[model samples]
Target: MKLLNDDLRNQLKEVFQDMKDDVTIAVFTKSGTCNTCTETISFMEEIETLSDKIHLKKLDIENDAELAKAYDVQMVPSIVLLNKDEAYVGIKFNGIPAGHEINSFIPGILEVSGSGEQLPEGFLKQLETVKKPVNIKVFVTLSCPHCPGAVQKAHKLALENEFINAEMIEAQTFDEISNKFNVSSVPKIVINDQYEFVGNQPLEVFVEEIQKTQA
Candidate 1:
């Protein structure tokens, strides 16, 4: 049972061709308790086969507790992307990046591989003002067409600022956490677990919400 079909594989190969540097996909999973853990690893295996520059590291949340703690992984079936230097740059996916999330996942790889587009000078300057630690949780449903855009925007902000970290959480898979946050809508962006907005908003909206944390 292959997760990625031939058509998707071919497309990913073409997309991965633009990778300028190596990127490691470190996936954390637990054995029996986690439902999507196995499926997520299988999906990642397919992704690794597409590009020589993309490396995969499979780990268990329990057995690799120390490393998982270092990366601040709090859940199973989580993914952390590392740069060519294997440094954790605060990009993460807490569930399988299937469906529309493939949009965010591929771009995340490219960003870590040093092939991402640069943010505008104005945006860069705005990002520089973020001095406080910020955690961005983007709650998404796989079927939502607009969810990936919000996830990508959150990830792009994380990549530009070391003080910020972002994770895309599949709302259905993490329903309990979603319930805690009262996520009744798709593409719900929660910043620092305090402020929240719903939509595929512009980067300016994201920055404004993040800046609110510094206040």
Candidate 2:
């Protein structure tokens, strides 16, 4: 069975029309051990059929170890989006972006395609203060309605600052990591594996939490 229905596919085509540049989606998956790897690839295949600007690259965690390492990918069914120049700008998804997670996934592609909304200048200035390396792991379940907003905010910060990297991790799919972070909520935001918060917070809240890491 196909993941995207006719209505969804048509809606996606309309959305892809707004893509300003090329986006290369590099997917990393490992065989045998990963339960969702096959389904993830099939979903991506359907996505690739939606637009000419969207390119899909299939890779394995084992076969593409060096490349995966360069992107800091440590899990299966991971997706790394590269910009028009094929540069990795630190946007990633660590599980199948299905269900409500599609909201973030689609916007991520548009952002990488150079058609993203611009952040306020004040907020852009605030982002400059982040000098130290920061990793944001947004733990979410596919069915969570509000989880995508949190994921989008995290990825937007990653796009604005080089020192920051963000990823949307499906909670149930990667329960071991979720347990490590003590995630019992729908949208759990963990920063640097040290600081954490829950819910679809405002941009100011995200900035404030990140500032704590610098201090």
Candidate 3:
């Protein structure tokens, strides 16, 4: 059965129409090992059909170790969003972008497709002062409504600052990593693997946390 219904497909066609540059979505999945791998691939496939600018690349994480390592994808059912030049813009989804979290997927595509020059002026100003790299990982569950906002902010930060690498990891799928970070709650955001907080935060607060880590 197809995942996207006719109405949703039409809506997506309009949404993807805003895409000005080519957007490539690279899906990494290990066959037969990850429960959601197959479904994730199917979802991406359907999404590709929505727009001429959207392209999908399928890969097996186990078979393509180098490729996976390049994207820092340590888990299956992961997605790497690239721009027209096939350059990774530090946007990743380390699990199925289902449920409410799916809302973040399209925005990620549009951001990377463009020059990612549409960040808020204030955030852009703040990002320019950062001299060090900041790595942000947001742990989320598929069902979490608040997860998408946190994930979107992280991706936006990555776009605003080249020194930032942001990713969204599915908490349930990556049990070991999630446990290591003590991710018992949804939308748990960790910055530089040093500072972490639970729940969704405002844009100013989130940027402040990044600045705190930089300090």
Clashes of each: 0, 0, 0
Give Cα-based local distance difference scores for all models: 0.94, 0.95, 0.88
Q: Between which residue pairs do clashes occur in model 2?
A: none
Per-prediction CA RMSD (Å): 0.7, 0.7, 1.5
Instruction: For candidate 3, give the lDDT of residue 30.
Output: 86
lDDT of 1 by residue, 46-162 (tens): 899999999999998999999898789998899999999889999999999999999999999998898999989999998898899999999999999999999989998999999
> 17-106, model 3: which lDDT tens digit per residue?
888899999999987768999889899999999989988999888888988888888888899998898887788999898888888888
TM-score of each: 0.98, 0.98, 0.94
Give the Cα error of residue 127 in candidate 2, in Å. Answer: 0.6
Worst 10 residues of 2 by lDDT: 114-123
The segments of candidate 1 whose C-alpha lies over 4 angstroms from its true place after superposition are: none
The runs of at least 3 residues in candidate 3 whose Cα sits more than 4 Å from the true structure, single-residue gaps closed, are 115-117
Show model 2 residue runs off by greater than 4 Å. Answer: none
